[model samples]
Target: MDIREDLRDVSGQIARLLALSNVFAENNKYWAHLKNDEDFNRVYRIPEKDRYKVESIYADGRDMAIYMMDALAEINFNYARYPTLTSIIEGFQNTWVYGNYNKETPDIAKEICSTYDIDLWSVRQMFKLFKDQEKLLAAVRATLAMLQNSNLYKEENGMPTQEKHPHQINLTGINSSSININSDGASAAVNQTYNEPAVFSEIITAIKLQGLDPIIEGELIDNTHMLAAGHKSGTFKDAYIDFMQNVSAHITVFGAFLPALSALL
Candidate 1:
């Protein structure tokens, strides 16, 4: 599973949504000015021909926004196993895309509405949608940064040349202590004082319960198993920390299990 590819796809979707949002916002600007006029009611009355055109424009933008939101939601569901992506996508949906106007409106949306004198609900909603897209884009970019760093380390170290067996590490009577790992003239001492067997068991059980891909499950199991066998490396530690940060960002079903899983680091 190439996580970077998945994130790139998400980024592309958000970019498209942002462009659509900008167009929608621009279109609404004219209506906003009309709303501020003293003769707004007389000028924009339902009987006016221009009123129907404005309504049509508004409906078109609203429908497109709804369609784009649905696409994002579908992507979120498709990547449900990745807690980080799911959490970010769901946050955008809850707080911006479909949040309640009276109670759940984002602070930025409120501020923008006030600043621009935008009293229209649809315009306010567009502002919220645009802001949400921006925030989610930032999150995805940050996650990609972490993933890229890990990938670069793996490439340079030529680590995991082949998939290791879950039982590859011998765990007979190994005491808890720090181990020095050296690769290509680079070295680091990483602490390995935790109970490896117990931690490995917890990770395996959690992965199985989550029904992750067999390849992913195997990789995770082998890494944990290696750590338990006292093969602690800086690269693995960094990857472990990155995973933990992503998981901890948003509370999910895996929240309770994170602390136990993190002990492997």
Candidate 2:
């Protein structure tokens, strides 16, 4: 076997895997930190060498948790300077160096988060996001694998090449904050203010009892993934219409937003 060509094929599979993982990292609340942890620590991002050794272990369920933690630590450290996400964005630096996630800057992330008293709760949130993202990631990975096995792409050096799938959406960096699901538009409410959902749920019930048809937004059971009321639109029919139209234009856009998937996953 031509090792280079064989490795190329494997690399393609890995890239697709990473892409799916990336989507999960973006969509699923838990995976976001995990994914961020992975993304932020790329080899180039490391200021000092010989800190982290990035390797591809088996892409199995057992390793998922570990990967997620890695990304969480990476993000906390990278974003330590700013208190808010917006401030971090405004002062964004190219820490991800060529998209390589290798360990660097020994205990740098730990030191930074420690200074701010940021604990593993941040990692916990990412795990919550992972729940939903996992489903979509699995679906996409299966689809890609099926295509590759069926010879969908042109073979060069006997490796599967990237193909433009009809349902492709660049979900690499999209986050819960990126999409605005407010009570004014959709019945879906995204609440991030409270640490516990029971309190929020009681508040929501009280609001609903008032006949406001309020859509509450906040961290759901998983704590990382954002959950809203089902897509019923309730008193917000106009928001529902807009949501439907947007979905019709590009369903993949809403793939990550479905309450059904969120509920089941």
Candidate 3:
């Protein structure tokens, strides 16, 4: 048995494992951020004199990534079910860097919510608007506020599940003073005044902050992405049509505004 061949085979396996991990990371937009190229060079402190040490550092990284992805997949699967408080979160032990989840939603998600006495359907609806963790959390805070303010959902003790005030909307850093929802469910009314004139820069900033990637000028741009126009009413009209037809958010505030605006026009 050639020992050199065995060493080469081991190196190849490590390389292959690392390559697959990278592909998965990219495909999922999963930024593991385990460490960057410079960090590896600095930590290992491999001198230029010993070129062979490079493979050793890479092999170590390969092993670390394998473990990181494994943990991330497990955690993400758990979060996929969300809207429920899980003891699993307590058990987690994150290191300096945090792992992201992007795995097939576990079959137990529904069951997990059921176990926690969480409303599965409502949770789904929440996720429909708030896709990521941060927004989801903010929305949760807002929903609890709605529930508490509704004068409904009272336990025998008569305590509130959601506290009043601290109501957040869109949570993209715009906490408008006028936007208030104290009613119940979708019918909950937002009773406030809007004397502040619409500032173009503010609207544009808000859109960009959402990472909506708005196109300002008319171009042969793909109709899929949301586009804004300075001129060419045709392009604007086309984009609006595409958005309305594809995005079924009629229940959303912005969605409701579209039809209302159309009627007014």
Model 3 whole-model lDDT (C-alpha atoms): 0.28
Error of 2 at 154 (Å): 14
Which of the two candidates, 1 or 2, achieves a greater TM-score against the reference?
Answer: 1
- Flag regions of model 1 displaced more than 4 Å: 1-117, 152-242, 245-265
Candidate 1 residue-wise lDDT, 1-265, digit = tens: 1224445533433333333333334434534453454333332333343344334433443443454445434443445533454444444443323432222233533454455454555545444444433333333333333333343334445654334232111111224333222123322244434222354456557767777678655444443333332213233443343344444422353455545443433
TM-scores for all candidates: the values are: 0.25, 0.21, 0.21
Question: Compared to the true structure, candidate 3 yields what TM-score?
Answer: 0.21
Task: Write candidate 3's Cα lDDT for 117-171 as tens digits.
Answer: 5443333422321122222122222222222333223432365654534332221
Q: How many clashes show up in model 1?
A: 0
- Lowest lDDT sum, 10 consecutive residues, model 2, at 217-226
Candidate 2 lDDT tens digits, 1-265: 1212322433333233333344334344433344456443343333344222211211122245344324422323344543332332233223221112332222344444344454444333333433333433333323233323433233532566566443222222233332223323334333344233343244334333444222222111111111221111121222233223323533443444444332211
> Evaluated with TM-score, which candidate comes out highest?
1
Model 1 TM-score is 0.25
**Worst-scoring 10-residue span by lDDT in model 3:** 216-225
